[model samples]
Target: MIDCTRAMETNDAPATIAVPQDDALRALLAAIVDCSDDAIVSKTLDGVITSWNRGAEALFGYAAAEAVGQHIYLIIPDDHRAEEDEVLARLRRGERIDHFETVRQTKDGRRIPISLTVSPVRNAAGRIIGASKVARDITERQQSEALRARLAAIVDFSDDAIVSKTLDGVITSWNRGAERLFGYTAAEAVGRHIFLIIPADRRAEEIEVLARLGRGERIEHFDTIRQAKNGHHVAVSLTVSPIKDSRGHIIGASKVARDITERKRAEETLRRAHEELEERVRERTAELSRMNASLRQEIAERLRVEAERTQLLTRLVLAQEEERRRIARDLHDQLGQQLTALRLTLEMLNAQSADQTDVRVQIETLQELARQLDQDVAFRVGELRPVDFEERGLRAVLTDYVRKWSKHSGIPVRLHATPSTGERFTSEVETMLYRLAQEALNNIVKHARAECADVVLERSPEYLSLIVEDNGIGFDLSSVGSIGGGVGLLGMRERAALVGADLQIESTPGRGTTVIVRVPAHAAATRIP
Candidate 1:
């Protein structure tokens, strides 16, 4: 019933069985092949497929039923068929290939990159029977390798130094940036201690950085000092992160360092400039304070001088008043008596010469002449001083003066007096007031072309005031100094100052003039002996 040639072919087929002692072992081996992500296939020495696993069906888009009797070149791309021939030749010589990467064709006509391992299959007698091949798709692994290369290029060209060190502070990798920064090539720096670039005094920084890296921590922008190849110190800002292994364990540290020496120098310069500016401001303030103190002292000295001058003026005014009084007394007591005696003698002579017409006429003329001289002397004495002021009170003196002045000037004058407190003022104060009133009336007669005048004298608890007002053609008060009234106004002001009083003059053209003198109560009561 069986064909002998077909039976022989079936008996020569390679069996997919291993002589394991237990079913568990065999089941595990089967699981390994079926669960693998790589395609596993076995073929005859002549290249006919003998066995195929689930992984092979998934990889080549072919089922075991479709590929078991097929040639091994079914999955080999057309251009890569020569690779298989060489692979088979090596296998025939009992050679094994590991990770031989090449392109192979899937059932969909697309070529896929794969890594392959091939080995010669042996029979129970250790004879080479076929080749077993394992092919793994390597698309994602190739893409990952390309990305890593790009990142390495970026690190090499960075301006800031980029380096990696182990947890034990050994330098593992150094980029071109690190080489330029530290003046060391990667060949020289790698495998050396990372502290080689750190300044001697700052070696402790490396210890701390390594300690932190061991704890899987990142340090960002830590400013510290480092050393260049020339032994000069450089200020640097460092950022360090933990470098991890494939198992996510911290294996080393990655660092980026930027030089900041110029920034530090600029900060120091700005600090010095700020300090100098503050010092200058303080010095200027002190100088201004000194100037202010000096100005205050100068002003105080000027005030003292003004006070002394005022005192001297007051004494001089009192002396001048005394001299006027003395002159008035001499004229009244001595010259007045002499003139009376001379007039009486002339009258007696005229009486004796009554019978002689010529002698009587001459005696009468001499008597008349003596009388006129006596009157003239009395008038001059009154002009020199107010003798009646000493004998009479201020009101009486003022009344007599105003009456006489009104009679002489033919000007109507009114007087008003009110003594609120019956306090008699000092003689000096009374004299000054009388003199001021006299001067004011004289000014009215000379300067104010008016018809009527008024005099007011009042005494209050705080002060004594005298006002002399005239209903006359007023003059410009501002121009009074340039006008002829300046001298009289000056004298009035001087007298007011001597008695510590205030003098005010108010006037306008066509309106009237008012002269007022106010003496404080304390000053009026003060007697200057």
Candidate 2:
């Protein structure tokens, strides 16, 4: 109990008093109020402090002696001074204020959040004269409430499904994220069994999860399938942990489920792609194996045909030379002798017919005809068999052939021979050189409207080279295979190849043509035996 009049007399110390019939109870109540953790105070209707407890002194950072006998505004901040007026007015009206949450000032000039409860104080006559006030610090409570609000917001906005369920598989809480992921609202999912979202095939999985959660075990990134409200399957990766209270007992499980439907689909596509790639590789390997076998067979056949062609060309060349020799022999031996005898017989007839003028004139004309006929046949024989060189070699035959061909074709031809010209070669080499020159000149006459041509023969210690160039309207080298001379060029290459020589034809449109042939010294130096 407080002796209000005595407390009002001096602000130095608290006055002790007693109730009329219950002094001990009054003392206990007074001690309880003074020792309470909340600030308890009393003030007159004029807002003057009449009593201040130790809690008041502790909370406001002022001693009871300093607070008592002062106006209630000693603790009420300037901004909250109006609150005191309303509190006093309510107190005078004998009304009680339950929990007026407001701000108060400590002696140190810091504002502290507090909740105030005020009740009217009345004497034995039941007339209100003063007010009793209790103020409790609510800063920690406010901080805790704000923290919970923020956590709730995070759970509501998360993209992954977050849910809490009791150990018995009953759903306790569902977040907005869970609502979106599972296609069920919080009102629809809460109070429902956890199996509401579990597919039939996955029900056993839920049982295992509950059993594991009962053991206080946490499962991270566990892959599973869940069904949505629409009955579509959702692939999810769940992170579930045991939600424990302050007592450290497993009460429920918290699940964080992420949607992995797209990820799972991507994995399946990659698997199929790998399988297809491997199949294609196997097919390609088989195809390549078959192609290799066929190519080998084709290469072998080409080699055999090429060998046969080489033999045929060699025999053809020899037979053609032999036939030419036979024809020339026939013309020179039979026809030349017979024509010379005829000419002689016609000369004798002319001399013996001196008595007959007209007959003698006819015999003289016949003699002249016979002589010209003999000359024509000899020239034809020389053309058929170019076998005049018993001692002529490669260089001499080529030079002489070039001169004769140019005179025959009326096209100027230049023969550029090295100092080794006229070196006696074997009959084969000599004939090959002659035939090559002949063919080249013949092609010039037929296709090349040339004003001049050059035949160059060069011999080194190791090789021989022939170059034929004409200043004619040249052709495109790229279109050589499509030109009129394509076959002729092929034949020339074949003939050169028979003697182990390299042949090249180089031409360009409007640039003239050049044919080059090179033979190895060992092949060109046909050993004369």
Candidate 3:
């Protein structure tokens, strides 16, 4: 009751009885205003500025006296005026907004992001009057944060791997690009030691890199080898930059690596093929020299024996030719005559035994056997000399060969041949090409685990190209040289060189194999120009 009487007495006191405490009140207000980092301003409900603190004056580029009577919308961007109306309406209703973020116009006409809070002011009778608002500038921090997020997103989704490792060689960060490049997931890579993915033989190189980094040296575009999850070595181009901590100490490294395994392999394959071709040329040249030396030696050593050797060689060649001719003649003459006689005899028997059904059946069987024998003889003769090369064309001859090869090997074969019509080529050239196809097909049937093979013969204006490919288990063409002249391959290459051709074999362990033979068409021409 006594407290109520004192409060009433103090309230009833006259306004003139209040003493001037200007200095103390000023100091108190100054301390309160300085405590805030945001701009604090008081304004009338009609939008005129009433008071301004130091933060408000600095924020608006105006002094307290200059801004006091001005519209508070001077700081509100033109685009945000509609939102300002809602804010004023809310403030007039004695409402307060806390931490409302928006954009504001600065003194230099620059737009700035800010968090604003506005509240209504009251008089002694507690009647809502003017409003005080606090605005905090967040433009720089917001822009910085957004830029960082964008860069991080790019790194996270890049195709070339980006990784970060601690000074102790511990993996600190892994991105999606790293996962694709290294075949490792973020969960499997992060917090793991960097040496986990490096090959044992490459640890020394990694140590050297760390030593360089410790000396504040950054490594850029260092081409090296890295191991994949499946233990295969992959060529990589790496750029390593130092990552500094808050105190500017080089604590870790950020590395960007691109997997160049495929490109490296292709280059290596081309290099190896070139080496093999040069070696083959050297061997062929050497072989030609040896053959020439043998011929010269035979000319000098025994002139009489030279004649004998020539005769012997001639007989050997003639013997082979004669055997083929004799077989062909026997098939055509003896067997053909016997078949004709048997057919005629069967016809006569069938006519005489018209009354005897059992005799007629025997005669019918004889006639059928004779016809089959004649067809068999014709096919054999065709196989011996595929005269289709002269009649139908080289294309037709190759087509027949591919068909027969597929039937014999049980592997499907496809042939694509280009026509070289009116281009007269040597019989030897035709035989060499056909024999190479035969030998390649035999090798594929015996060794290659191929489901399908392709034989493409293209005769261009300058070159005749034959490409034989198989999706089969592949062998190293280089290793074939070490195997010291595989008889079949040697024969094929010999025939190619004899016809002024080049033979190249390309293969990788798991990928497949292709044999390409290119010959100068004019060199192999049989025309007497």
Candidate 4:
């Protein structure tokens, strides 16, 4: 009887339905939950955690076993718990919380900002059973948005023009500096072409730069002079970079512009000032040179006049010598013969009157007077004419004069000369050269306590050089000796110049003295009248 009742109950019970399709649907749902990166969680109407997916464990650092039995309020901060309840309450009322952004604490005590999409979980009877939420970590995106805000603030407050352009040459961004530079606000410039700020003539160059940017090229630090709204030119240094899309496709250009008009103006002003300064310096130099030349010309002219005076004085002295020569010749030819004849007569009378004692004495006295007069006349004639030189030429003249000087002073003298040298020099050159040599030798004899002296003359094709050197107690050349001590060097130098030559003197105290005269050889060569 109990077996028949069990069979009757089993027969009345419905057969078990097939569950293969439900198993397949559950597998698909599990795959979706495992694959999602966002945390997908469901909570009961009372705020108990009902479901936790893998993304929830990764996001909150809690596994399903740990979080499923807990209230969702655990992740909500104390300050935000009330708002979170209201959000869940609204979600349970079949309302959606679409992209509600809020901060939730992670299991590691980090407050993470998230974007949450919450909706109602419904039962088969269409009654709300719980709330489901899709939460995505939006911390990085929020930080990035804050960074962009700070960068924009910096660009807006900058003093330099910061502009951006589209690949089509339209202005997409204009900062405060750009508004000041081009006299246009962001409102007026955004959709306008960049060429609005460019001058008509310079637009082409800017166009070319933009075209290059469109081709994915960057122009860094491109310097150009651009026109301002006031028609004045402003020099600018521009750095442009290619703007790219998410896939790195060149889209437009971003540019930073710096105004360098002041620098350029300062440079131009400096250049002009430098040119003016140089011109002034050149003018002053030219004025100084002209003044210097004038002074030199005046000095030269004065020297020439003085030289003429010296030559005239020399001519006067020569004229006086000529007169003396004439007088000496007359005395030798007329008075010399008369004196000789009278002296001979007196000698004859003295001899003939020797028998008369008184007469003979008077005659002897007369004869002595006549002989003394004749001697006086001959001496005067000899003084007027250099008789030794008349017979012996220049070498004898110098030798005899030097010998006499040596004898008078008891100073030893050495003489050296070439006989052939006398034949080559004209009268004037010979005279000047002889005088210069004599004057140099005289200086040595008078002031130079010299042990030895050398006088040399060299005649070459172009010039004649005369050198007089002495191993003497030399004086300082700077000290110029006593005014009268050795002006002879100056006289020699002057004579050298009169003949178109130069004189050089080298002397150091306690060393030696050398006087050199370099004269053109042809200076005194005879010219046909």
Clashing residue pairs in candidate 4 (N, C-alpha, C atoms within 3 angstroms): none
Clashing pairs in 3: none
Model 1 Cα lDDT, one tens digit per residue, 307-425: 88788877877677687788989999999999988988888888888899999988888888888787667755775684454456677888888888787677999999885423456
Q: If ranked by TM-score, best first, what sequence of candidates would result?
A: 4, 2, 3, 1
lDDT of 4 at 285: 96
The 10 consecutive residues of candidate 4 with the worst lDDT sum are 8-17
lDDT of 2 by residue, 111-162 (tens): 9998887877776667777877888888999999999999889987999999
Off by over 4 Å in 4: 1-21, 276-529
Which digits, one per residue and each the tens of the lDDT, describe model 4 over residues 325-377? 89899999999999989988988888888789999988888888888788768
Each prediction's TM-score against the native? 0.44, 0.49, 0.44, 0.49
Tens-place lDDT digits, model 3, residues 222-265: 98988878887789999998899899899999989998888889
Give me the runs in candidate 2 sitting further than 4 Å from their true place: 1-26, 270-529
